[model samples]
Target: SLLVTSGPPDSSLQIWQVVPEDSADVIKCVSAIATENCTGQPWAKIATISARAPWVLHGSRLNSVRITDVESRKNVYVAGSSSSQELSGLAFLDCDTLLLCCAEGQLCLADVRHPQILLEAAPIPS
Candidate 1:
């Protein structure tokens, strides 16, 4: 198993590998990457690991989101929302599809293959 974590104050994301010990699980840092320096919030607020792909999607309290390749330990894509709302949630619908939610109740669907174009977006009802 793998675990994804973000460090506050310091802009960094780390991936850990879970190893099965005799009676407990031991985790070791497998890979890490530095995130973009957001002026206010330098740490990731939301993160999700893909089940169908070796990809990790994370976003800070800003409008930008990053996609990292676990196997290569490199950033594969970076996208930013046109809206100024802060990111609230992150998830993977499939290997290629991603779901993102904003603090202002907006939901966005994006395709990993084409990170620039948003597939769909709508406001969620209160």
Candidate 2:
């Protein structure tokens, strides 16, 4: 079972519903969505976000998306990328904090509960 980020402007994310049978290598995609943006490259890194409520965040590089967290009642979007670097990693530090690492060694922290509040931390040279 994998929640992978999809591409294009249609399906920004997809839950690679992997249903494993008896065989260890036998994995099946039970269901899948369409594409949305970002050249449709499946991102390798995936993570689940919990912000006082459960949130499903998924997307690829340069994909402007809007996710509605029904539990917390917040609209989350991909932070605008001012640089050429793409996102390399994503993690939820806590219920309200999210950490994003860019390919250009830029690390960012944001408040998941509030999309407008973000912090541009120090960059790590790659």
Candidate 3:
């Protein structure tokens, strides 16, 4: 199994591999990648791993969502641009689709292949 984590203080994302040991399962960090254009900003408040692909999605306080390729140890795409709304959660609908939840009660569906296009968006009823 693999795990992805974000470091707000370091402004980086890390990928960890879990290895079975005799005594206990050992978790080791396999890769670490620095977040671009986010030197002073927090990296991620919410994150999600893709079930069908070697990808990880992270949402930061800057109202941006970034997708990282674990195998390449690099950012493959920035899913959405910055906005007034803050990200509250992130999930992978599929290998190419993502669900973004915002603090202002907006839910968005974005495609990984087309970062600029919003497949769908709606407000969460209060």
Candidate 4:
């Protein structure tokens, strides 16, 4: 868990929590700090949990990634899936539903509360 990071050298750092072993695909929480001028500042939860190659698509490279939380639905948004060997190929799907990574490869990003386990990384098709 990354909490309260300081400057370039980051003098002030604290240990938040330890990730367990059973967690296959665990999304960690991130908090943001206020500016120096703010006397009484509060840390806000910035983004939901995401991982390496979080946004995946067939025959594409991901250009951008964004997350949205609304009353109707909460989702993880991604964009720029136009390259195969590129990490910026694929864009975000409509919502956080079961993703079709390849012809025989199935990548399902389960719900935030009940996340699906990612056993392996699908090889980007040529």
What is the C-alpha local distance difference test score of candidate 1?
0.72
Across 34-76, the per-residue lDDT of candidate 4 in tens digits comes to 2121222221112222343222222121221223332212243
Error of 1 at 36 (Å): 1.0
Predictions in order: lDDT: 0.72, 0.53, 0.70, 0.29
Model 2 poorest ten-residue lDDT run = 59-68
Evaluate model 2: give its lDDT.
Answer: 0.53
Best-to-worst TM-score order:
1, 3, 2, 4
Number of the top candidate by TM-score? 1
Q: Pick the candidate with the highest lDDT.
A: 1
| Number of backbone clashes in candidate 2 | 9
Off by over 4 Å in 2: 1-12, 16-36, 40-44, 50-54, 62-84, 124-126
Over 5-115, each residue of candidate 3 has an lDDT whose tens digit, in order, gives: 777567677778999899999999887766653676645754556565577777664246778777876677686565746667778877788787776667788887898
Give the TM-score of each candidate.
0.76, 0.56, 0.75, 0.19
Error of 3 at 68 (Å): 1.0
RMSD of 2: 5.3
How would the candidate models be sorted by lDDT, starting from the highest?
Answer: 1, 3, 2, 4
| lDDT digits (tens) for residues 43-124 of candidate 2 | 5344666544445554344233234353443555555444434567777787666677766666777765667655778754
The backbone clash count of each candidate, in order, is: 0, 9, 0, 17
Q: How would you encode candidate 1's per-residue C-alpha lDDT over 7-123 as one tens digit per residue?
A: 765767887999989999899988787777564674675456656567778876435687888777777777745655677777877777778877766778887788777754654
